[model samples]
Target: MEQVVNMGFISIIPSLLAIALAFATRNTVVSLGFACILGTFLAGQGIMGFPTLIKTSLGTTSFAWVMLLNTFIAILVAFFQKTGAIQGFSQYIQNKNLSRRAVQLLAWLLGMFVYFSDSFSPLFVGTTMRSISDKARVSREKLSYIADSGAAPVSVLVPITGWAAYLSGLAVGIGAIVTQEDAMKLFIKAVPFNFYALITVIFVGLISGGIIKDFGPMKKAEDRAIKEGKVLRDGADPLIGKELTEMEAYPGIQQRVFLNFILPVIMIMTIAIGTYIKLKSAKTMEAFLFVMIFMGISMFIQGIPFKEIMHTMTDGVKGAVPAIMILALAYSINSLSKQMGTANYIISISEGFLSPQLLPAIIFLIASVMAFATGTSWGTFAICMPIALPLAFSFTGGEATTLVVACFAAVAGGGVFGDHCSPLSDTTILASTGSAADHIDHVKTQLPYALICGGMALAAYLIIGFTSI
Candidate 1:
């Protein structure tokens, strides 16, 4: 009877509502906002007391924390751009005179270099490598594809990164079922199974620089770039792009582009190294915070003056306005959904959908669906971990290392796939806007590739499940 009640409550209405908002408005913030409201409603009042939902649902920590973090990250990224550090770095890469293929390969190589500093990976790589990819006529979607793919996957796969440490903590929290060392080992094993990320790296190399058929919308974008002999889309020069244009004129300006570029790189590296060494650990939030501070300092020293620093931060905040709101909304939905017992409700309804022999496949499907619906890899992991890990751990007779690894891989792949397709995703929009490609074009071109990778991962999961069991 209790199980039945939990099942009815856990159907995930809050998540559904969030998904609806995202699609309806085609805005990530709006989708998240609606989801948060739904979560608050669930938490503050029973489903029956719909009228008082708004008044009661005002307090939730998830909404607040996610907003704060988003605000900070956005501001830092914007300030880095305003300081001309990005341009300096891009110019340096272009100066190398590498062929387009060489440029694409270099971008992949650099992503590996910065894998230890997860938060800095996207910004740092995007800041520097996008320039060369642009010059070589790689589409913005492809460049972003490379950047996003490498950032989190590489960070998490390596135990040395902040992400690895974060997962370790999650493992510890799950308690008794798996040790920290075991969790780390499982995480390492899962990397080879992360089909989306590994394949993305390979696809970037093949599709860019004319190695394979660019048959979809991506091919069109590529063709246009080549004919024009430029990286930006027609009428969309990188220098004049809105994000880049806002900070072109500033103080402490380095005439030597190389100096402008190298300084930021050195500063970011210094912060990451310093934090890891000073703390004798890799997982502090301070590591993230310190990197932001160093990034800001480097920009200021490069030529952005104190006055501009304030503006840069403000600009950063403005960029994050949408992302912060969406994050809050996402958290709200989770709070409400869990409060209402929505996840349990769904599990009950779907109980026995997979036989005990097929438990691994069912777990993967659940993780993927949740991730795709929520548009967050971390959220998917957090929610599923509490339920899936415990159940799998119990089912496997306390040896769930392999199952945990599979589940983690599923969520990771699903999240990236969602981000690739989610028109409301911040990274998706940024990739389009950054690369001077049309927003829809990036989505359309990348969707096929993401799907392909996802399929491969699923097949891999099945193979591993059957063999390991």
Candidate 2:
């Protein structure tokens, strides 16, 4: 055990070094790839040669799950887009004669709902809502902020998502550390305490309602937009100007666009409710089937030819390939960390910090840090479960709920926190890309909101930890 742990810790050195290098150089893809390679090398060690390591590193269940999830999401997105659903949604928002605040609120709700449907929350929500947000004259920063706020955080809150299921499975594997059931229960409790996610929702409400004025760079951008009667920045809504041109030349496609907009949503909601009530144990496959069915229904309703739907599905899957590659690489790195005992090393470090009054806070802090570092809350939970769960059992004196909630909250909140900021994180990239906002701009503008939420979450953890009742 000691040897495995030592080797595991040693193996992480390359990844750590690579991340530092990436940050220093500001090369996102290179930095991520280097980290992934380092992880694979450390995992392979001597048991497998470089070729085997490379193959297995990219061939894990985590990688497979990404492919499956992305394929489904891409298909659904494409179906909606090709059928003109997105245009329809945008039209409805514009035609409603609603206030900008109302549009922002609706954007927030859409963001939350999209988070539940796919891990690609940023792309799903941003792509669908960009047109609407633009029409409302909401700044791209605010749109990205709303999308980022709800994306991963909401996923962490839900138990039936890819994020939740993945983390729960990880929790179950750590010898007697934590059970899948216990891990999930903890996640549920932590949802309320997740200050970052909660604060994000609040921030949107406040900002949209004019209770909070834009400030700093965001303020400048908004001012420029209002004064110039247009966005002054080059990075403003990458998709907007381009799509407007296309829609103008092809006005016929815009005619029944609203129907396309409503179809995918109705389908996804029905599936979400069905999965929640009937197939409680549904996995990625169940979700895929549900989404596919809805797309089919959409085709029939929209009078889209079957061949056209199939073609769109193919195109959607193609678009998802890049994200799939990134996800696969990420999963491979995580799996390698597990096999190399890096996870156990993490657990070992966390074990010494355990205490009764501080246990929940510790869980929150530790899980958040680990999730942020690893870019996977589920990975963080998997690593901590073996360590924290058993400690919780031994130290809680019987307040399992407290321990469970703390652990769950830490993992869920931390995962969202990490994914929110990580340069290499899929959601971060997708949000920017989908919104046609520069990736760095999106990251920079939206980070404060995430940090604010993180602060609130920390306070909530302390409150939950200290105040009995």
Candidate 3:
């Protein structure tokens, strides 16, 4: 194990291998599986480490929480389809005859409004806006980009979200942020300097508003949709299977169709927001569970039989299989990354690059690369904050300078760049499933836009660093 730790370049092989295979083959499961196996072997474990690693990775309470949440959201999507609620809502929006720009704008707004949870925001907005966007001739790639732009980027912008809480908790005892309140204040102070999140969000809005035109792979998808009227590309494999995407409305389900959709959403926002305000930690899963319970009872009372309800739930679970399989492999590889001390190796190699005038930009670049390779923004935040904050303090002689705040925001925003674009990011996967877009296509189309924003953010961080001196 020590030998593995000392093997600096070896730590990154698995993640890099995953990235290369994913792009070359366009198969997430195969890419992730091979990376997991290679990573396990590299960590000094034999072939038997594969199963053991899977058990340890997926056995965590965190993985269970994500698994159930993904399943529940899928089930809710199934129920929405089965009851014709989603259709009714889409028809209602389409009946207004909103233009494509307006429809995209609406989706962007929906994503921003669901600012409480990164996990919830993209999926909810994607599911809630997919049909309407399709009817407006918007490509699924565009929809995924909008959904993703508003996810981790938006979550980190707001103060009450789980992202904020986790970040603030990490910041505690660092520099001037000794208390939770102090950490929160520091987070807020860093918000405006969080250049990537700000730019990414604004870019989405501008694109949606028709102030900016589509470019890169996204433009190709949009062109295919506009000229051919194909919302998804021909032969694209969507993460959400036809089981839920094509699920028919249950027989004898007729009345209050729109209400069926609205009530549960209301319940989720109410409970999740309410708990976060009162309890600091957001009970996001509980909110989804309550919505499910309400939907089950409400649908039953709406004259759908109990057997049909159970059957719809079953179909929902089945539809979750494709996404879950990919996610399981993703988790396994991420676990291997942790065991190999991949992020630590990154930090170690980055040590020589830190200086006051260049620190902010360098930190942002390092965080971005680490998050991209590992596919987890929060993991980057967790590892980077402890090091970045202490470095910022030492560089500033413990005075709260512009450099310190800029560094803080650099890590926050840079990590989100990975979440927005990386194939292995959960938010990216959720965006695909929610929009029923091909996962690889989503990654491909969104990558250019994310990189543009990342480039702008990097420039801004550089300015902040030089000017702060």
Worst 10 residues of 2 by lDDT: 242-251
- Candidate ordering by lDDT (highest first): 3, 2, 1
Give the C-alpha miss distance for residue 104 in model 3, angstroms: 0.8
In model 3, which runs have C-alpha deviations exceeding 4 angstroms? 1-6, 255-258
Candidate 1: where are CA atoms >4 Å away? 1-83, 117-119, 172-178, 208-212, 224-245, 256-261, 273-305, 325-342, 390-396, 400-444
Pitting candidate 1 against candidate 3, the one with the higher lDDT is 3
Q: What is the C-alpha RMSD of each candidate to the true structure, in Å?
A: 5.1, 4.7, 1.6
Model 1 Cα lDDT, one tens digit per residue, 273-352: 66665664643234446656776676667656777787777776765554344444444444455456654554555567
Q: Write the per-residue lDDT of candidate 2 for residues 1-469, one digit (tens) a residue.
A: 4455546467566446544764565444556667766565555565344346558766666556656766776666666666666666667668888877787787778777765644556766777777776766776767776776677767766766656666666555343336778656655665776666666667777876678877766676566556664442763334222322232212234445545545545665656656755765434445556767766675666566677667666776666655555555555555555566655565567767666666666776676665555556556656666656555556555455555556555655665676676544656656654565644556566666666767777777777666643
**What is residue 462's positional error in candidate 3, in angstroms?**
0.7
Candidate 2, number of clashes: 6
- Give the candidate number with the greatest lDDT: 3
The residue pairs found clashing in candidate 2 are 85-260, 85-261, 88-257, 88-258, 196-453, 238-436
Q: What's each prediction's TM-score?
A: 0.75, 0.78, 0.97
lDDT by residue (tens digit), candidate 3, 345-408: 8888888988988899888988898899888899899889988889999988897788888999
lDDT of 3: 0.88
